[model samples]
Target: MNIRKTLATLGISALVGLSAAQAVAAGTIKIGSFLAVTGPAAFLGDPELKTLQMYIDEINTKGGVNGMQLELVHYDTGGKAKEAVGFAKRLIKKDRVDVIVGGSTSGSTLAVIPLVEKDRIPFISLAGSVKIIDPVKKWVFKVPHTDRMAAAKIFEDMKKRGIKRIALISGSGGFGKSGRSQVLALAPEQGIEVVSDESYGAKDTDMTAQLTKIRNTDAQAILCFGFGTGPAIVTKNVRQLGIELPLYQSHGVASKKFIELAGAAAEGVRLPASALLVADKLPASDPQKGLLLAYKQRFESKYGPVSTFGGHAYDGLMITVRAIERAGGTDKAKVRDEIEKTRGFIGTGGIFNMSPTDHLGLDLSAFKMLEIKHGDWTIVE
Candidate 1:
């Protein structure tokens, strides 16, 4: 009887040891991302995903954060807010992620914020919306500046160029409406006049009617706003209508794909964007030079080239990983606390200063004016 008891006790001990080993093996930190990889906003999400992958790969190579491998599991939201909410629930409940990243558009990010707050997981949004960080939930953070800041920059530049009368064209989408509202609200304050205001839906391929109306007006410039393929259509229709005035666009259309989509019309178009997008024009003395170069080289080595969307993703992931490392564990609450204290951490975007009051960590100073010249972006004075 004693011998039989001893054998059973030994077996139980061995089973416990095996279970502990399995737990340790499965302790890898999982990060979640929701993007519109297969929808109208794929141009934005695809590069953002690629950049997240590149940063994850690099972090792992240098001994991952707190000795735990960072695993990013992403869902395709297809540019729908409902899809984004569903995906957020899955990431929080099923995947049990330590953190979440990657929201391609403002509407999708806004939809997922509540879930992130409820689950007490830190979310670093890649989308640019002042509202995303404004009412500032403790768990929600953003790496991109708000659309309001970009709109201000556009108007400031217009004022400098002596452009008083402008034509405003925006798609009837979340980003478009937000940008149009901000511009209209701030134009009078900045002494700029909107001679014509036009709107179009995202699916509309032809904008000649809107462009023609603006062309007939005494507007000295055209301000285009949209994230999807609408900007390209507007650019094409403007050229087709022989409207040769200066063209200014929101940073939402700041990507190499925009140039490809707009073709010749893309040339000489100005927009406000994070300095990382125009790295080539920055001198070596610039603070962001080293970081941007490293990111560019690593990204190009992994994925063909870099884009502004990719830079935002890289900044978001890096900030999240840094906070995780500082926390020394994957505890959600601890990570959230550390993220809120992140100050003066230089990123490709700019210095991040995530406080309890402000989660965006960036302001208008984080952006620089850029103009497309000869199929490439150059910093504008």
Candidate 2:
């Protein structure tokens, strides 16, 4: 044990320790997102992806989350459930993401929840599905209001407005079916009778027949539900048939593209949406005003104008980041536990409260009733 040899070994050990510490400090946190970037639901997924990119860019520019750069790895599910499941597995097993976000629809979100839960990763679903958070799953959370909540709001509004009869049309998909069932189930309680109920396939190009039947009924309004191109078809056909009754829709049609696709037909359409979309018209001192403006300016600077879908993504990702910050690390389990304890989180959407029994983080109060006027969404009292 010569003195020179002892000193050399001690220096080598110290260098190795410093290298390990640096590696840990410089580690990157990977977030995975699956969306229908190229399929029928591209209208929703494209803006959501853009929002995720904008948020990550801004976070990185501000030194990132906890001094670690955030990396978002996205996959295009093409509106297919099987592809979503496969991508989720790849994100977990290969990319090794710290969390998952930005699923565009209920089907895609629900398909990936099991994979996330199996891998014990935190997943914040941007999709609006009550089932995504129902039963209080530990690894899953959602940003948008559930179809049941939207249905209740729509029906309650109709009842208040003295609409006694309604015709329902929804696509034969998970999102559509869920919304339709919720509306139908809640109509009786709201004292509004569903005069006629009809459904069409997701790929249907025209719903003339269904709209005609509803038009012949004594319904005062048409309640439509679907994602992708189905909603557009419903709106177009309803207009082409010259049905003058009011059209109420699910929040899935909150995107600007929905109005573009439906053109003039969407003028009087009504739906429930997060307050962020109509924030410009809200009072300046509103609680969500600051956050919404900040998010809007950052998003527009990074990637053009922001859409409602983008707003949802921004809210979801920010909440996820806040949970990680509170946890002090990227440990998935710890973050999930903290997320369930989220309270009074004043995000771009609204205040949220996530509990062990409530994973959506939002309630009926989170949504504001809105109507499309002159191709723009206007808040309704």
Please give the distance, in angstroms, between residue 168's alpha carbon in candidate 2 and its true position after superposition.
0.6
- Tell me how many clashing residue pairs each candidate has: 0, 0
Cα error, residue 340 of model 2, in Å, equals 0.8
Which is the leading candidate under lDDT?
A: 1
Off by over 4 Å in 2: 1-26, 239-242
lDDT string for model 1 (142-188, tens) is 88878888989998888899999999999898889998998898899
| lDDT, candidates in the order shown | 0.87, 0.85
- What local lDDT score does residue 17 receive in model 2, on the 0 to 100 scale? 95
For model 1, where is the 10-residue window of minimal lDDT?
21-30
Over 8-113, each residue of candidate 2 has an lDDT whose tens digit, in order, gives 9999999999999668645788889999888877877998998888779879999988888998999999988899999999999988888998689888888888
